[model samples]
Target: MTTQQLIDQIKIKKSFLTIGLDVDLEKIPHHLLTLEDPIFEFNKAIIDATHDLAVSYKPNTAFYEAYGIKGWMSLQKTIQYINLNYPEIFTIADAKRGDIGNTSSMYAKAFFEDLNFDSLTVAPYMGKDSVEPFLRFNNKHTIMLALTSNEGAFDFQTLNVSSASGSKELYKQVVETSQTWENSENLMYVVGATKAEYFAEIRKIIPDSFLLVPGVGTQGGSLSEVCKQGMNANVGLLINSSRAIIYASNGTDFAQKARIEALKMQQEMEEIMNLRFNV
Candidate 1:
């Protein structure tokens, strides 16, 4: 989907909430285990329950990759279901993939060409060559990892770096330098919601670009803090919640429970967007 289309969807739904589909077989209810594809079954129910309230769905590849071919098959079915049933909803492959030139091309194809995801998360540590390949695709987005929510991110992303150009923090340099690779029209970014305070500085660098922010619900990142600092004229944020919404209930009412959790977030987002957009 184009950026405008995404904005339209968010407006239509009154939400920028992106539900993360990180399905874990072990944790899902025992009743669902009877289904041939329990993962997709659970996803279908969750999507069915929450589709009206959410504008995006992000599938983290690790959960599927762990089970080998079967898990992959579940992913394909789930993605297909989303495209067929809810084409308007933006889909993101949260693969965090970054590799050399040729390899990155194949990675791009695997998500954008083959699976038809609207966006894919990429690590920029390998530099432009690793990211430029993904940018070549038309209408598809390459979401670079800027400030992450992981505990280990402070190990490197927070370090002060004195480059050939000048002195800057590692994450800031990554955000500023990566903008030169491609146009913001096709590039979004992964800025963890936990880094809400830094959004003001990050937005100054790339004001118009959308940010795929994680760590909202489960990670204790305040939504109001992010909206206050991160929102632009267009409300440029996709705050994701995986465990908090998806695993809200383990019983048969799990899907309904998920919807309840998602609706709560959407309601808060709607209030924020209405006031932000009106003024």
Candidate 2:
């Protein structure tokens, strides 16, 4: 999907919410295991229940990778279901893969072409060469990890690095440098909601770029705080809530509960967009 298409969905749905599909075998309802593809079944119900309330669905690739071939097949089934039913809703393969140039291109093809994901998460630790191949795909987004919500982010993301402007924060350097490699049109950064305060400064560097923000619900990142700091004229944020939404209940009512949680977030996001952009 193009950036405009994504933003249009957010507007049409009155939501910037992206539901994360981090399905755990042990966490799903016991009854679902009877199905041939429990992971895909869980995902299907979640999508059927909450697809209208959400603008995107992000399936973290590690969850499927852990289960090997069967898990991968489940993920494929889930993607096919989404593409067939809700083509306009953005799909992200949260694979966070980054490698040498040739390998990166293959990874890009795997997610963008074969699996048909609209975007994929990419790590920027290896620098431009590792990330640019993913960006090369037409209209597909490369979500580069920036100031993450993870606890270990402090280990390096904040380290002061000297530049012409004196000491610059590491993440600021990454965002600035990456912007030089590719403009915001096809590039989005993963700015976690736990690092909400940093969004203000990051916005100064690239105000219009969309941010695929995780950590909103289960990770305790405040939705209001993130929108307050990160929202731009274009409503440039995709705040994800995973366990809190997907596993709202371990019972058969899980799908409805997920929709309830998603609606609450989407309603708030609609109000935020209105107050920030249309007001």
Candidate 3:
């Protein structure tokens, strides 16, 4: 999906919530295991229950990769179901992949072409060459990691670096340098909501670029703070709540419980949009 189309969905739904389909077999309802493909069945129930409350659904690739071929097949079915049933909803392959240029291209093709995800998470540690290949895909967003929510982020992302103009943090360098690459407009970013204060500075660098924000709910990130610090004219934020929503309950009513959590976030987002943008 194009950036405009994503923004349009946010407006239509009065929400910019992205539900993370980071399914864990151990945490899912026990009854689902009786199904042939438990992972996909769990995902289908969650998607069916909460699709309207969210604008996007991100399935972290690690969850599928852990189960090997069957896991991958389940993931394929999940994405296919989303594309076929709710084409308007954005899909993200939360595969934080980055490698050499050629390898990166193949990864891009896997997610963008074969799986047909609208976006994919990419690590930027290997620099431009590792990320540019993913950006080259038209209408597909490459969400580069920036200031993350993890405590380890302080180990490097916040390190000061000297530049000709002055001194800036390493995360700032990544954000600024990425804009100079090919098909940079297709670039979005991953800015963890735990670092809500950083969003103000981040916006000064790339005010219009969309940010796929994780670390809400379970991570104790404040929704209101993130919205106040990160929201732009387009409401440029996709706040994700994974464990707190998807694992709300592990019983037969899991899907309904998931919807309740999702609905809470959606209601919060709607209130923020109404107050901030008068939408």
| Model 3 stretches astray by more than 4 angstroms | none
Highest-TM-score candidate = 3
lDDT, ranked from best to worst: 3, 1, 2
Winner on TM-score (1 vs 3): 3
| TM-score against native, each model | 0.98, 0.97, 0.98
Q: lDDT by residue for model 3 over 1-279, one digit each (tens)? A: 889999999999998999999998899999999999999999999999999999999999999999999999999999999999999999989999999999999999899999999999999999999999998888999999998899999999999988875789999999999999999999999999998999999999999999999999888799999999999999999998899999999999999999999999999999999999765
- Across 72-93, the per-residue lDDT of candidate 1 in tens digits comes to 9999999999999999999999
| RMSD of every prediction | 1.0, 1.2, 0.8
Poorest 10 consecutive residues by lDDT, candidate 1: 178-187
Q: For model 3, what is the alpha-carbon lDDT of residue 9?
A: 94
Worst 10 residues of 3 by lDDT: 161-170
Which lDDT tens digits does candidate 2 get at residues 100-175?
9999999999999999999999988899888888888888998988899999899999899988756898988888
lDDT agreement with native, every candidate: 0.92, 0.90, 0.94
CA shift at 105, candidate 3, in angstroms? 0.6
Model 2 misplaced stretches (Cα beyond 4 Å): 182-184
